[model samples]
Target: MIIPDWLSDLHFAFSHRGDGQMSFKHADKDVVLESRNRFFHDKGLNLDSVVTGELAHGAEVALVTEADAGRGARDRNWIEGIDGLVTDKPGILLMTTHADCAPLVIYDKAHKILGQAHAGWRGLASGLIESLVGRLKSLNGTGPSELHAWIGPTIRACCYEVDRDVADRFPDHCRFLAGESIRLDLTMFVHRELWRLGLNPDYVTDSNVCTSCNPEFSSYRRDGLNTQAMACITGIPE
Candidate 1:
């Protein structure tokens, strides 16, 4: 429950600790459920107040109003075909899962609107961050300057090597390296996107922890297909 100082004002949660119930340490279902429950209880929210699903690594954004709050997490409904969630509703948590992929959490302080995104190579190449910011602006009339962003733990360029095809998908600005073997700085790319959207550079924070490089955190690129994922959750207090 002790969020990093960078995002303290934003009412958010993240885990370096792997969940035990989720099969994979990073994706332990039982651990995630327990964490969600604890988050809701500690925040004085109902179990039905958290919203999340099986992220598809796409650009599809789910608009969560009060009605949809907590449905997926509590009901165990399949959140198929979606990669992001946004809401202005209080007490409703927006969550996303990741191992090496970065979890980007955005908040509009003035409007109390928050967004959670799953940004991997595909989602980042697809401009999911821009789309999510645009959606938040449309829903709450809050501009990018009013938003605060946090980029969570992910595979850093030092440890993340991609093929040319996958690396080339990003624009020149987003690409950190290019050669027979390429390294992509996903956290930096997301930060660049936030700046492009007009959010103040000072307001953005990066965890700077690389999953692939750190043994304490889970890493699919290092651990292979069976690695677990960490969940990043954020919301407004009731």
Candidate 2:
């Protein structure tokens, strides 16, 4: 589990498969508890304090609160029709899962606001990034410039070949024709949108580590293998 340096104070972690699959999607809820306990043991958080969303691959972004904590620790919290979650509350670990899609993390220390989002191709096309940024901005006067963002490790254009239908959604600048197929670059796409929305280029960091190409992370594209899921979590620390 690695936390972005800019978000050093937060209880954030992007876990790889070796860290133990931090998921309860199967019948064994203990898998989630055991994995989370080990990963966050001395970090002042527990698996039961986590709040997660079922990735719907849409643009719906939900606002979580103190009461929403522990809703999905053992059982699915089931926030419907949403692909993103935002919160101003502390200690409640906000998380989402991904294999190929980019995990988007955003924070505004000035307002103590934080967000975690899953941006698969569907979510991206549905305006997940813009919708999330807009909603966060509307709260506490948080603007793009005030927010710091990290585009976590995901399948890059090198591994993300798509059909014309999927490729046509993105502009030419965001994709290129590679042989007979088109490849989309979510990192570049998000960075462009962030800048267009007024975020500072310096504050936004794209790991540029391709999950499919990098051996450190898991990739569905690399094999039929799932990541145990990349556990992307962000929150305000107490």
Best by lDDT: 2
Global fold similarity of model 2 (TM-score): 0.91
Task: Estimate, for each residue in 171-237, the C-alpha lDDT of model 1 and write its tens digit.
Answer: 7755565456677777778888899889999888777788888877778888886676665777777
Please report, in order, the local distance difference test score of every candidate based on alpha carbons: 0.73, 0.79
Model 1, residue 54: C-alpha shift (Å):
3.1
List residue ranges in candidate 1 displaced over 4 A: 1-6, 21-47, 74-76, 176-180
Cα deviation in Å at residue 20, candidate 1? 2.8
Model 2, range 1-238, lDDT digits (tens) per residue? 3345767778877777677766666326777667767777745567666778888889999898888887666677657678888888888888887677889998987998888888888888888998888778867675678898989888999888888888889878889988887898877888888898888988887777788998778677775644566677777887
